[model samples]
Each structure stands twice: as C-alpha cells, then as structure tokens.
Target: MNFAVETPWVLAGLLFMLWPLFDDGVRHSPYPWLDILPSDAFSTGLTVLLRILGMATIAALVLGLAGLHRTEQSIEHIGHGANIVLLLDRSNSMDNTFAGKTPDSEEESKAAAARRLLTEFVAGRPHDMLGIAEYSTSPLFVLPLTENKEAIQAAINATVVPALAYTNISKGLAMAMSFFDDRELTGSRIVLLVSDGAAAIDPDSELQLRQWFKQQQIRLYWIFLRTANSPGIYELPTDSRNDNADAMPERYLHKFFTSLNIPYQAYEAESPDAMHKAIADIDRLEHLPRHYRERIPRQDLSALCYQWAVGLMLVLLALKLCEVRR
Candidate 1:
C-alpha cells in the first residue's frame, strides 16, 4: 500500500507549478475611466481560484511523468490448513493401470487417478500453501510453495505426461524437504509421497535423509499404489534368504520411514476408489492452524495521475468560456 516513484528526477518538473502564481503577463485593453469603476471582489476571488487550478494541473502532469506506483507488500494470513508438499513419483510404471497393463477405455492409469484426486484435494483446501515435486531418474522441482490454487492444480495436471525410466525417491524426498527451507514452522508440515514403486537408497543417502527428517520434524505420508500381483509394504518374504533391501524395497522403505520417529502414515491403494479415500483422509488430518505471509504485486499509478490532469484541464476550459470580455 506504499507509494514510490521510478524516476525521482522527473519530479523536478513540479517546479513549473509556481509559474501560474507569479506570472501576470495576461494582456489587458486600455480603459481611460478605470478609476471611476467600483470594487469587484468576485473577480478578484475568481482570479485566485483560476491560478490555483493552473498550479494543480501542472503538478499532476509532473507526477504522471515521475512513474508513480504502489510498492509490493506482504501481509500475514492465518487459516486452518497445513503446509504440504506433494512429492510424486514419475516412473515408467505409473503410466500403467492398477492391473499393471496399459489402460483402455474402461480403466485409467495410476497417474491419471492421482492427478484427479490431488486436484480435488487442492480445491477443497482454500488456505493451504502447497508445493509440487516429481522424481523419475532424478528429482524435478515443479513449483514452489504458495497459496495459489490454480498454479497447484496446473502442476498436478502436468504430471500425466509420459514418465522416465527409473525412480530415485531418496533424492526426491530431499528436494521436497528443501521446500521448507527458510520457512517458519507455524503449522503442521507434511510430505505426501505418491508412488507405485520404490527403489533402493544408498546407505550414505539414507543416513542423510534420516538426519533431515529429525531436524525438520516433518510428517510423512506415502500413498502406495499397489499394482495387481505386486508385493505390499506389509508382506514378508517366505524364504529368509530373499528378505533384503534390494529384494523387498517397498517394505524396507516403509521400515526406514517408521524408524525416523516422526509422524508417518502409509496407505495401500489398489484401485482408484482407494486412492480417493486416502486423499480424503489426508485432507481431514491436516487441519492445523497455519500462519504465513502472502505477497501483493506492485501497481502503477501513472495512468491515474494523467486522468486527473485531463479532468482538471476540462474544468479550467469551461471556466475560461464563462469569462466576460471588454
């Protein structure tokens, strides 16, 4: 709401406003019996009024040239919502249906179902500041955290594009964690991971991720899209020889998250309806009071100044026409 000028030097033109006050160069016709005329107070007042209007007109013109504008500002907002980051997996398998095959007219791909449900989730939360991050072979920063619903929806819809070959979720989680950098913890901070598959994380990366979760105190939620005939997070290998991180990555990843000692939940979704329900549950759980600042963009006022100048000039023209001549 504060005002500023782009070119301060142009304001010097406002000095021209004094010209109307001091200049008495208007021509007058000679009158031999001027001393016999009676005092005219109305004319004297009208002359002063006209000079003031002239000064105002000049001042307006100078201000218009100065590029006046309102500076950008940030205002604090409080609402019942959480700061959430949508950490999505964009691997090749996400392009298939829940049955692990290309979708036909009767079925929808996992990514499509996720995009639809997440769009609805965003629409329902009016005050939540959400960010989008996707990971395939590497993590991609899609959008920053903001209260703009349209932008969040657009980023979700764009996830339906053909995905890459691999899923490096460890790096993706790191990127999602980075979104909260320099952000105040005024409310619940949640990381919602939507993925159909999992990959093994190196020991070094795993240690770093654990430290980050401890430092940030972030809540984690994983919506596991379980394809038909695939092993679930809770499933145990029948033979003890095959129970390792590489063999059952989904289970180990879940175990790693549980050991972090932060608030964490995992939902196994085998169909579109299950995905919808999981998203709904998340919407219900993240209703904590949040406080954040929203920025307002700068607005130019030069056009307003010019409009005022034009209006005053029209009024002065009308008064000039009413003057009586000798």
Candidate 2:
C-alpha cells in the first residue's frame, strides 16, 4: 500500500491555530466542554466522536487503505514479478552438440550449451524466481522454484549423460505445474523450453499440453537446437542405435514445436559464435524486458496530503473538547 505523511505536522498546526481562538475564549473550569452542556449532551458528543473514529479504523483495516486518496498511477514499483518457471529439456538429445563443443569427454553436449545460455539468462535476471527439470524417458526435477541461482546452476551441472532413450514431454509439464502448486504464484508465470526436439509426443498429448499452458497462462518459449545439421552427430554415443552413431533425433522434435502455437527459433551454427547468438537472442527475450525495467519510472507520493487530513481532524476535534478532556 502506498502512503505519505505531510512534511509539516497538521496536528501541530491545528493545535496552535485553535489555541488563540478557543483557549482564551473558554475558561469554564475543568471538563468544561461537558460543563457547557447538560450531562446528556456531553455523553452524546463523546459517543458520536468515538463511533466516527471507530468506523475510520475499521475502513482502513478492511481496505488495506492508506487512508483514502484519489487514484493515481505511480511507477515506483514496476516489474516486481510474482513468479516464473524454466522447463528445460534434458533428453539424450540435450547431450548432443548443436554447435560442436571441444568434442571431447562429457563436456560439450547440447544440454551444456543450454546450461551456458541459462547461466547468461540467470546472471542478468537476479530478481526472477526460477526452477529446473531434466526430461528424457521421463522428466526429473532438478530444482524447485528458488532465487538461489547458484544452487540451480549447480544442479544443472550435475546432470550426467542421459540416454536419448525416451522423451516424456507431458510428464515434464506436469512436474513444472506441481512446482507452482507448492508455492504461491502471482504475476507472469513462464516456461522457457530448451529442447533438441527428439521426442515423438502424440498429437493429442501435445494439444492437451498447449491448452493447459494457455489456461494456466504460462508463456512458452522454444529454443530448438538444430541438431540434425550439426558437426558432432557422428561422434554421438550410440550403443546399438546408430550405424554411423548419429545420435540426433530430428524428426519428432521438429514436429513437436511446429504443432504448438509457441513462438520458436533455432541455433543453426555449429560453433561457439552461433551458440552465443542463440544465447543472446534468449537473453534479449527475458533480459531485455528486465533491462527496460527502469523505464517504469518512480513516483513521488502525493497521498501524504490526505494523511495530514486525518491528523488535522483529530487535533482540531481534540482542542474543541480540550476542556472536557482534562
């Protein structure tokens, strides 16, 4: 609730003003406001004053009102986000390189690229609440919605090589929704889906997911890594799945995004420069808005004038009854 107190105390001003006018003219002994009237009159005034003050107190509490003020838009508080969730894909395809990494050891999977991009996103948005999930044969909860970016990054790093064995897009969505249920969600809830698109989810399931996301008002983002044309596919690990060890699962993934109304883009290059561009693009989507957050502008409180109204009333009413107060 917005509030303001007048710079010059109204109570003090009212007391001084009433002093010369009423204090000198009145000298009807102690408890004189009551003395000026019959016993019944004093009782009625006291009762009326108490009743009015009681009503004011009740109004303030019920409305969360900072007294009453005319409606004015103040930009003091902007982009104070309520909540958001990052639904990242962690299937075996994530382990496949879109743009080739060092191409040695367990270091350069598509998942790694996505994580690096996520780090950039996290670095820029310190205020955003985020969570994570790794989906393949099924999606696994890596972290809950938290402000601890370091903890979220650590969990992402710990995810090891996964089999492009199976894809559970539905389960991942369900898990993400469950995270919101565990906490209180208020403003723009979002899900940034970073996928290599290997899973072949059913049409019905995909439509259901889309409807659910729309109803829940969760904004979906698609960062589809172009694995079909990348350099590292031949080197991809395939126990018996590929003759050439081509680990990229291209068809199902493309079909998944194209079917959804979600806006999507791809990282076409197979090098660091291309990967950086993809990261930059995503950063703009999430971070640019944050960067422009300052544009919301701040407001100098004007409602403070009304608070003085309350104080002034109290003071004048006091002076009018000062003799009786004693």
| lDDT (Cα atoms) of all candidates against the true structure | 0.92, 0.56
Q: Give the per-residue lDDT of model 1 (tens digit) for 16-43.
A: 9989888622446887787788879987
Cα lDDT of candidate 2 equals 0.56
Model 2 stretches astray by more than 4 angstroms: 1-83, 99-102, 105-107, 161-164, 182-185, 228-269, 287-326
> Candidate 2 residues 75-140, lDDT tens each?
322353434567777665566665433345645776666667677767776666678876777778
Flag clash pairs in model 1.
Answer: none
Clashing pairs in 2: 4-304, 94-111, 99-270, 136-166, 197-253
Root-mean-square deviation of candidate 2: 12.8
If scored against the real structure, what TM-score would every candidate get?
0.85, 0.50
Model 2: lowest-lDDT 10 consecutive positions: 288-297
